[model samples]
Each structure stands twice: as structure tokens, then as C-alpha cells.
Target: MPVASPIPLAPVPPMIGGGEMGDLVRDTDWSSTALGDYSSWPASLRTALSLVLNTKGIAALYWGPQQWLLYNDAYGLALGDRHPAAFGRPMPEVLTDIAPVLSPQVAQVLATGDGFSIENLSMMMRRHGKEEETVWTYSFSPVQGESGGYEGVLLLASEMTQQVLADRKRDRAEHERAQALLRLSELNAGLEEEISRRTADRNRLWLLSADIMLRCTFDGVITAVNPAWTDLLGWQESELIGLSLFELIHPDDLAHTQQGASLSADGHAYARFDNRYRHKDGSYRWISWSTQPDEQQINAVGRDFTAERESASALAAAEEALRQSQKLEAIGQLTGGVAHDFNNLLTVIKSSTDLLKRPDLSSERRARYVSAIADTVERAAKVTSQLLAFARRQTLQPTVFAPAENLRALASMIKTLVGAEVELAMDIPEHSHFVIADPSQFDMAIVNMAVNARDAMVGQGRLIIRVGPARRGSEANEQPMMPGDQVVISMTDTGSGIAPLHLGKIFEPFFTTKGVGQGTGLGLSQVFGFAKQSGGEITVDSEVDQGTTFTLYLPQASEPREPRSVEAPHELVHGHGTGVLIVEDNPQVGAFAMHSLTDLGYRPVLAINGQEALAELARDASRFKVVFSDVVLPGMTGIELAHEIRRRYAGLPVVLTSGYSHVLAEKGTDGFELLHKPYSVEQLSRLLCGAMCTHFSRVT
Candidate 1:
């Protein structure tokens, strides 16, 4: 409805060039509208105008010849005490010092016939009598008067010193960026050359390595070969280049080599193949190859195992043949020697007994003859036992004890056996030396050696038994019997020394140089057997007409044991007066023991052997109180018999008697009550009394 009288609008500003405003609105132009009545305004008003419009509070000012009329309170305060006087100053005179320092923007605008301005143009301004520096900016524009005539110039300026400095900093940053870009271009140009140099260096390194290296395509075509690869094959790298790896492989090994290469290519991180490769001279050598795949190529390294492989094969063959020969030699020696010794033993026993049956022998002579026969037979049996021990057929009864004490205990007997003709000496230290060995066997070993030494001295030379601590060094050729210390017992004789040729075989069975009945070559062998079986070693040193020394090294004991003295009565004595059972299969032996017991004032029960003894036991389990039996019986053995008796009579004193101690005393096999064979009336009596005393003492 109001459209009829729609708008008679006020005239718009002249459109010089069409735009949001007009092209005439220059970026550098600063124009202002008067509020009202300029003539009526006072000096105070003028001052306020200078701060807002004349100065650069929010507004800026321009005057003649593009001079800076005034900035603002911000600009004036920066000018300080002479602010108002600084108004309307010529732009050159006002900023003569600062203009030179500004960028070329002002000069450019003036020379180009264009109104130049910037909303945040920055500059540093130094006012008179000021100690600190300040920054500002101005706009340069042509002036026009009301008469439409060209006047001077005008300036619309703002203090933009912080902004101006920031702009200059941006320009410096752009220049630095350009220089950096130029350096980067140069670095990129050298990158390819550096990469090539590193690759060459890596190739040289691979060539120098001990391992043979090769680079190949996925198809097994050799692309590059290191000097190691060429040297190992006795060929040049050029000869291998572009050649298939299969060409170098032995014909029989090609299939496996291909399989490994295929596996490496098929996503296996690495694959290995050991095979024979053909050398340049047409020979095959062992090579262990390891390969890894990378994208489309394969890298491989190999080792030559030919020399080691051939040596191992030869060694294996030699060792196998040697083992067979050693086994056969040992068997042949044992068989041939054992048969001869057994026949000789049989011959001796037969001949000795045959001579004892002469009819002219008187009772005394007959008794002596019978005793000699028994002694010879016993000696023959010992020979067999020693042979068994050498053959490792004899079981040893080992106990942990001091070897020194065992040797010392045998001192008296050794002295007696050596006779008063020879001076027997001992060198034993006072340390607590130990050994895991059979005390009786050890004693016998010492005695046999002493007897040999006595014989060697012709019963008249000095004999020295030396006992000391020793050990094998870490670099020793021989293995130690035990983990630590060893007790050495060496017997030296200053008599007829052994010949060098005879030294090695002195410990061999039946190898004596003496006439028949003078020596049993088993003496030294027995010593050897006892030492070896007891986890020890024996060494003999002898020189012709000089002397001989037999050293026995026994393992040392690990811990301390209660002190014990091996004492036995060798004279006539009384029994325990307790009930004693004498189980003997042999009538003569039994009657002699029975008479001995009667003489000892002890009650005796008679049984044939283990059978009769066990029967008497079944009849009355604990009636007899103490069972004395022989070790080797008719039906059951003595140890078995002890077990049976123990079942019926637990804790009953069972005394085991043996010839040469079948179950050794060291092992504590039977009970503590054991009577060694050929026991005198006194020994039998003492053992019986001791067992009874021990039994009653335990019971009480």
C-alpha cells in the first residue's frame, strides 16, 4: 500500500568507479567529516580534536604536502612533554632520522603517483629530548581545497612500529627459507653418489669376510659374487656372474639346493642347505649354505666343511676298528694266561698232596706234612682269587676310613715278615688321611709289597714305606680316582732293582722270574688290583741294581669317622663262657674247634654247616644265644644263613667265620662278629666272648 509514494531518497555520494563504495576510495586515503562549528571550538577543544581526530587516538590526521598533522593521544604520549608542538610538523622534518631507517614503501608510493597507505604500517620515531625509541606510521595523500584546486599534500598516519618490525622479520624469514632451499638442492645432487659409494664399500666388506657370500635373483641366477665365494670355489667372480647356482651344485645335490632356495623365496625368512659343490678342478667339496630372500632377490652365505668332514669320517672308521682289536686282544690274553695258571695250580696241589702220603712218615712228620699240604692248597686258592680280581670278577667290600691308619696297623706284622735282617723304615705324616677301601685287602696289599721288598733285598737291605698326600694336576693325563686329595703309599727297596724291560710286566699274573715255590707273580698284581678296585692307582719305578719303589695312590676320605683299632688275639685264651654254636661242615675242623672251646671253658653246640645250624635254630630260635658259622657252607651261604637266623632271632649275635674273608670286614657285610679263617684257639675264644659281652651289654 505504501509503494505509491515509495521513496524520494537522499542523493548518494558520487560514484567515481563502481564498487562497494567506489574505486575512488583509495587504500591510502584518509577523509573525515566535521561534527559541527569549527570556528566556535576553543583551544581545549582543539586539543581534544588533536587527540581524537588530529592525533592518532582512534583517528589519524593529514595536512600540507602529505605531512603528518597529528597522530593520537597514543602518538602524542609517545612524543611526551612536547606533544602539542609536534602537531602539524612537515613529514620529512618530523621523521628525517626515522625515514632513512624505514623500508622503501613510502618512496615507492610517492614516486608512483598513487595515494599510498597501510592500516598497520609500522615505524620507529625518536622525539627530541627523549631517551627511549618509539615507533609509528603515516599515510601520504594529495590534498584538495574547497575551490576544487590542488593544494599541498596530506598524511593520515598511525603508529604501527610493532607491526612494522614484525613485517620486516617476516621478510628476513622468507630470505632464510630461500637459502635453505638452495642448500637442500645441492645435498640432493650428492645423495646418489654417496649411495653408490656405500654400496661399493659394503660389497668390499662382504668379499673380505670369511664366509662365502652371493647375491642372486629369485630364479637362482647369480647376480654378484663376493671374493670369498670365488675363492671357495677356486673360480673368478666373473665366471660365476649370470650363472645359475645349480651350475655349481653337485648333480646329486641340485634337487635339495633348489628346494631350499624355493623355500627361502616362498616367505621363509631364511633357509639352509648342506650339500656338495663342484670346485673349479672338478672335485666336490662340502658346503653349508644359508639363504635369505628380500623382495625379488636372494642373499646367501656358505662354509666349507670338506676338510673336517673327511677327517671325521677317517677318525670314526679308525676308532671302530681299534675298539674291536682292543676287545679281542684283552680276551685272548686273559684266556691264554688264565688256562696256563689254572693248570699249574692244579699240578701243584696234586703233586704236593701226593708226596704227603708217604708211608714212612712219623706222626710229627705226618702232621708237618699235612700242614704243608694245606698251606700249598690254600696258596693255590689265593692265586685263583687274585686272578679273578685282575679280571674284574672279584667283588670288593669298600669302607670309608683312613688309609694311613690301616698301613700303620700293619707295621708290626710287616716288620716281622721282613725279618730282623732288613731295616724297615716308615714315613707317614700326622694328618688325618682317609680312603674308601677294604682295610684287610689294603693290609694284604702292603704285606705282599713288603714281602716282595724283603725278597728283593735278599732279606738284608733297607725297606722304606712312605705315605704322603698327593693329587693329579688339572693338566694330568690320568683321571683321578676321586674328586680331591689322594693318599700315596710308596714302598722303596735298596736291594736288587728291577730291569727296565721287566718293569712294565712286573704286575702281570704268573710272570715271576723266580724258580717254582719261591714266588707267585701274583704279589704285585694283587697290589695293583686292590689299588684300582678301591678307586686308586699304582705306579712302579725300578732300575737295575739300584732300587725299586712301588707307589700306591688311594683316594682320600671325605669326612671324619670314629677312631677304631683293628685288634685281634693271636694266643690261647678263654671264650665268653656264654653258649656258643660251632657250625662246621668239616669234621676235623669242627673237632679241633670243639676241643678249643672246651679248653676255653665255653659251652658249645655242634652243627654240620649252615643247614644243620639253621635246623637247630628252627628248633629253638633263641636258645643257643650266639651262632658261630662258616661263610662257605654246603646248602645256603653264610650271609644268607645270617639273614635267615636274623629273621628268627632278631638282634641275636651271629658270628661269621671265613677262610681269607669271603665277605670282607671293611664292608660290615655280616654282623660285626667275624672270625677270619685259620683262627687260633685264642681268636675263636675272644670273638665268642666279645659277641656275648656285646649282646648282654645291649640287652642290659
Candidate 2:
């Protein structure tokens, strides 16, 4: 049992020199002050002042109900021009400039008979002769007097003005960066919309360019020239029209121009050819060009590069700009597709929420509506998780575990999900050794492949999950994975196989063969991404009327996995008034947890964020046996908090909960046990109790 240290009505240490403040304290006008004469001061005041004044820390003491102030030399400098004369004055007078910020803290320490701390406390005070912004990390504790009452507040503080300002600066910079990215994204999206809206107008915009733009027949007879031909080459639009394109090119540049034109002859096109065109004055001007062609005519756009001709860098830069434009066009197309999918999901969620608002709904209908909302939410989360995974933004937490054991464990669940008509087969060995991977993601990948297989079989066919070890294998899937000792798991379906035409697109996001509402097209892509991220590879094999199979090859771990301690599920213990800190940002979720914990005979503290939870624990860390926190929380994530707690309090266990988090998905949750969202009260209790019980036994 931890015992509280009593607040003594004495000095913090041995009585000694009071540093520079001692002379001023002795000479102060105490006769006209709250404590009468300085020499006749109470022993508690003298001892406390002496201890505080002698220390190097910025310490101070507020003595008596009047709160007489005293401080060391370190704190005296903080007083600016009022250092010496400020000694022994009532704290209220001395602290008049910062009273609003300091008073509540002092009152809190006195009211609770405990210490109060504020980090980066901001204040606008008359410091250095003007009102200025100041920040500090400060602490105040109640000091007991000779009569054992709350005498004053002991002050311990440090200025954090610079650090606070620096942090604000960084936050502003990050905000700006985010805004810039958002603007870029919006602009990219708008560009796509504009292009789609003006496809026909775009041809006119290109044809009437400031640089030369023209159309010609297959035999090179010029059909049209924009105003740019007249502006640059001193030729009327009518004069340029009906002439052969070869007549416009300078004699020395004709060969190169023909080479470019020849390439565009068979409905193929080429770009970045440099040549010269004849001006009306007979001089030649250099031009760099791009051409597009078809069976009837060829279209060309050119920009004058005469002045920049000596520098090849300019030509290269122009080519790069053209390439970038094409890339953005492709990206815009992808974004449009993603937006369509997301909007469909939002429609379902929005309609469900609006329906739930109707008070006349029946319980069964309400339940169905709620289930619809949950399903859509889960689907949305999975889609986002897969997107993050493909972008390599998800964190992976890898552990060494035998693939064979887990495959067997998931056999029943997989069978249930695939339905009764499908015959399930497992070819897993008793022990295929261990492999390193995120077990959760690995399980998800397996499930995704199995579901795809089940669907391919139309709910009625042979689905086989085979696990084994191999040194080398055929790369039927064409993925380039490292070749060495490996653990391979294959999910095979005995149904109509994928056609050759669809093979390349099977792993593309949003490319699904399932009917309109049946699939999200992220499953295979997620599997592919996960395999690649784990230093493994996934491949597919299929033939029409035959079967389809997805094989995942993972590098084998060098060491064997240690078996877990076996505990009977029925023997799980219950909490006996165990103190738990529940850190959840959602009020409904927090209230439910608190109520559930109370019913289970546990003392639960509800904190809406990681900071509040830390403050509660800091007050009396030993009172809490466990911390249950949402993975995504304000200020600090559950994963980060768990790390901090493990550092500060070794014996404490943290149970992190999340429905879906990019951080958790990318950076695997290790050390801390994860509790997925939508968990039951019974599940929470068992996890909390099991962790506490296991850790307690380990400590003993």
C-alpha cells in the first residue's frame, strides 16, 4: 500500500542562508505588514521562507491568510524593477499583475490540499515595464501552518515562453502546409471537372494558340492555320491555308520536319522535334513541336524556341511540363472514381441517420437501420484503410507467429463466413514454424482472399486453404519477391476461373467484377499491398471453367515462436473493485464503458482525452490497475499513451481500442493488447482482468 506523505508545518530542509533575499527580508517594513515585525514571524514562516530563499529553483512562499510573499534570488529577477522592495509584501499586492492567472491555481491547491500544476500557462502581465505575453509551467502546493491549517501556497515555476511560441510557430507552419495541399487537391479536382465539361472547347483552345497551331491532310496539304502563323511568320491565314506544310519549313529544317511528320502518318504521334519555319522576310525561326494524327488529318501545335534555342534545358523543361500535365489528368480521373464511391457510401450513411431520427420506427426496423449504419461505417473504414495501405502510410506491427496455428484457429470462422454449400478444406501442417507479420492484417488478407474465392464459387464449391514451407517456387503470379526459405499460404476455389482479359485489373482499386452493390474492389489490392509491405508476395492463377487461387509467400522467421500461457476461457477472473482509467473522446462510448465497469464492480475514471487521463494518473498513479483508451483520441493516441505509460509505470497495462486507424494499421500495435471497436462489455472485462491478472502474476 502506498502511503501519503503528510504536509509538515516546518521548512522543507535545514535552515540556512537566504541568499540575496535574506538582507532585504531582514530590512523590510514587516511592522506595517501582515506578520508584524520580521523578527517575530512564526517559526513555520521563517523556516519555509529560509528553505525557499536558499534554493536555486525559482521558488516562493506565501505565508498567512494575507498571503505575505517571499522568494529566492531566482524568482526576484522575475520581478523586474520591484525585486528588493517586493519582499515581505502581501502576495496579493505583489501578484496584482498576474493575479487572474495565479489566483485560481493557488486556490485550487488550498482547496484540495494537494499540488496543482499547469503546463505552458499563458499570462499577459506588466513585465519589463510593458504589458507582454509570458508563458510558464508552474506548480502550487498547500503549506500547512503551525496550527495545522492551509497557511499558504508553495510556488515552483519555470518559464516556457520561448518553447510555447516555437510550438505555435510550428503549428502555424503545418496548418499552412495542409491548406496548400488542400488547395492543390481542390485545384486538381477542378481541373478534372473543367476538362470533362469542356472536352469539345479544348480542341478550339488548342487550335487557336499563341504559338503556331495547324491542321493538314494525310499528304501534308495545309488545311488551316491559327492567327499565330500570321503573327509570327508574317503570313495571312488564307496564304498559309491550301499550301503544303513542306513549303513552310526552311530547306535545312525540312528533313527533320519530315521525320516528325512520317512518324505521325500511321495514326501514331510523336513530340519534341526541333526545326525552323520560313518567315515572310525569308529568315528562319526555330520551333519545337508536338503532333497528333488520325486517318484523315494531322494536327500540330508548336512554340517558338528561337531565343532559348542555345539551351537544351528549356526544351527538356517543356517536355517535362507536358508529361506532368498528362500525369495530373490521370490522377484526376482516379480521384473522380474514388469520389463517386465515397459519395455512394455517404448517401447510405446519411439516409440511415435521417431514418433513425424518426420516433415512430419499430424496434426491429430501428435495429436494422442501426445495423445498416454500422455496416456502411465498417465498409468505409476498410476502404480508407486499404487506400492508406496502398499508399504505404499504414504502420505495420510485426510479430513472429506460426502461420499454421493461426490458420487452423480461423478455420471455423472462415467456414461460417463462406456458408454451408461450400466444402472447406485445410492442408495446413501441424507446425509450419514461424513468420514475421502483423497478425491482424495477415488475418484480414487471408479472409479477403477466402471471401473472393467463395464468391467466385458462387457459395457452393470446394475452397481449400493450404499452408506449407518452401525454398523456391514458380512465380506464376509474376510478383518479384525475395527468394529464400519461405512460408506459403494459398487459398484456392473450385469454380469458374478469371478470364485472361481481367487478370491484369484484378488488383486495381475500384475495379470490381461483382454486381453493382456486391463488392468494393479494395480486397485484392489490399492483399497485394500487405504482402508487398511485409516483404512477401501475392499472386493469382486461373483458367476459364477451372479454378482460381491466390498464393501468398512470406519469408520464414529464423527462430521458433514461443507458445502462449494457456488459460481456460471459463476460468477468466472478474474485477474486484479494480480502478480503471477510461480514455475515450466519444461521450456515449465513455458513458457506456463507465456504466459497464461500475456494474462489473470496478472503479472507473472517465477521461475524454489522453491528457486528462494522464492528469488523473499523475494525481495518484497507484490507484489505477489498467487504462482502457480509444486508439484515436485527442492530444495523444492510445498507442502513444501506452508507450508513455509503459515508460513511466512499468507494471501498468493499456488496452487500446479502435474501429479503424491509419496509424494503427500502418504502425502495428505491439506491446499493448488491442481491443477492436464494437466490442462487448464481457469482452472488455475479460481483457482488462486477464491483462491485470497476467501482469500481476509476472510481477510476483
Which candidate number maximizes lDDT?
A: 2
lDDT of 2 by residue, 483-583 (tens): 66678888889988999999988987767889887987878888888888788888788998899988898878977556677774333345678899999
For model 1, residues 567-594, the per-residue Cα lDDT tens digits are: 4434436545656788888899888888
RMSD of each: 23.5, 36.2
Residue 646 lDDT, candidate 2, scale 0-100 = 90
Q: Which residue window of length 10 is worst by lDDT in model 2?
A: 1-10
Model 1: how far residue 299 lies from native, Å: 11
Candidate 2: segments with Cα more than 4 A from true spot: 1-433, 438-444, 457-465, 471-479, 492-501, 542-547, 558-564, 568-578, 584-603, 606-612, 631-637, 660-667
- Cα error, residue 152 of model 2, in Å, equals 99
Candidate models: Cα lDDT each: 0.68, 0.80
- Return the number of clashes found in candidate 1: 13
